[model samples]
Target: MTLFAVDIGGTKIAAGRVTEQGDLDGPVLTTTTPATQGPEAVLDAVAALVRQLDDRGVTAAGVSSAGVIDSSTGTVLGSTTSISGWAGTPLSHHLSQAIGCPVFALGDGHAFALGEAVYGAARSATSLLVLAVGTGVGGSYVRDRKTLTGSHWAGGHFGHLAVPQAEGLLCDCGKVGHLEAIGSGPGMLRWYYRHGGDPRLLDARELFTTADADVTAAHAIDMGAAAVGTAAGGLVNAFDPDVVVIAGGLSQAGPRWEQPLRASFTRTLIPALSGTPLIISETDAWLVLRGAAFYAQTRKDIA
Candidate 1:
């Protein structure tokens, strides 16, 4: 059976037709998510994309989004500044009503972890942690092959962990010294700019590219890697996950960040768990959408 999946991000909305085995059947349709748009607009955008797939006979829909989602009720409890008016919105009910089909809402990080566990690097592991480091850092923990959505469905907000650095770094969540303040792609770039570094000509990709050939860029990459690795190590020690998967745009830095990240993780792992492995995603950017599709397939009652 084919399921329709929608991945909603701060900047874009992507939709595709996915088979039961998580194979995407056609080119994904995408549209820019306007910064000023409210939750209604976001819902409309998702509905339009799902309708396109529905026209092709797709019935079940799964949505992965960057916000606190109440999966039990299909509502978006809250979101970052990128998506306004999402708080208290009944996203699942709206989408289902709009498309005339069952719809499931999932946190983007949880969906990404599910995708990796089912089809990507973490497939063999029963307990895993998946971290996506993009515009912001997001994480999800899977144990016994089940995604853990804590009370209030806000379990994976790991990026809010306090950083060891001084308490001055501001996070978009209106907090200071959070992990995302120094480790996320935007956070890293912002840190560089604040430290008298010029990143005007660089996005996260170019910054990592420059890191390979420039000393200053390398330092920036190292700092970012250290922050990420340190956090991963602490998480590993605390949770003792069998595997940790890194996914998202920053994973594209290749060895520029991966080596340092691994080194930091190794330095931080408890002696007993030093043998644990960290797997970097091969196809980081698309994992969330694939996972959403996987979710749609497994929840057969939704179809």
Candidate 2:
């Protein structure tokens, strides 16, 4: 059965079709998320996207969403402020009502790891982990092709880990010295500003432009990478997974960002786990959407 995969982030909504064999079909359809209009409008937006699909042979639909999701009931337990009024929304119920198909949902992190295992970088690996560092940090670990949602559905929140001991680094989750406070796009930007790296710098792009020569930009990037790498290292020690996938906006910033990440990740991993493949995801909008579809293919609750 073909699966309709929907990826709902704070800024965008993307949809794609996943064939039974796990290949993504056609270009992903895209639109801006109506996050500001409140949760109902966001649900309507997703339903509208599903309505445009060729549903004749579709058997199920899945969602990768930007929140802590209760996967069993397909409800969003909580979300970042980016998605206004999204908390406590029954996602699967609403989508099932709209599409008339088995609807499944999971936090975006798990979907990303599932996508990697089935259709992306980590294909052929029995166990893997994925970290998506973007506006904020999110990730999931998959073993035996099953994504772990955790008892509290907070399994993949690697960004909130206080692995790094940096001072004054506050995460959006209202914590101090979190991975997100240093590893995400905004985190790097916040670091740049806090370190007095020319207050006029607007964002991550501008900071990276001169990172080669600018001490502050270079320092911020390395610090962020170190936090991410350190956190990843800790996870590797804990899970002993075979592969790790790194995706998200900062990953696209090229080696200026990645060199440090790789270096720090290397520094953190133990000897036996050192060879675990570190993959840089081709994490475009399509792949992120495909992650959702990939998860639905195996999620027993929906099947």
Q: TM-scores of all models?
A: 0.93, 0.94
Model 1 per-residue lDDT tens digits across residues 41-138: 88888888766764466768888987888888878887767787777888888888898778888888888888888888778898998888877888
- Whole-model lDDT per candidate: 0.80, 0.83
Clashing pairs in 2: none
Could you tell me which 10 consecutive residues in candidate 2 have the lowest summed lDDT?
Answer: 294-303
Highest TM-score: give the candidate number. 2
Residue 239 of model 1, lDDT score: 88
lDDT of 2 by residue, 179-243 (tens): 88888877888888888888888887887898877999999888888888888888988899988
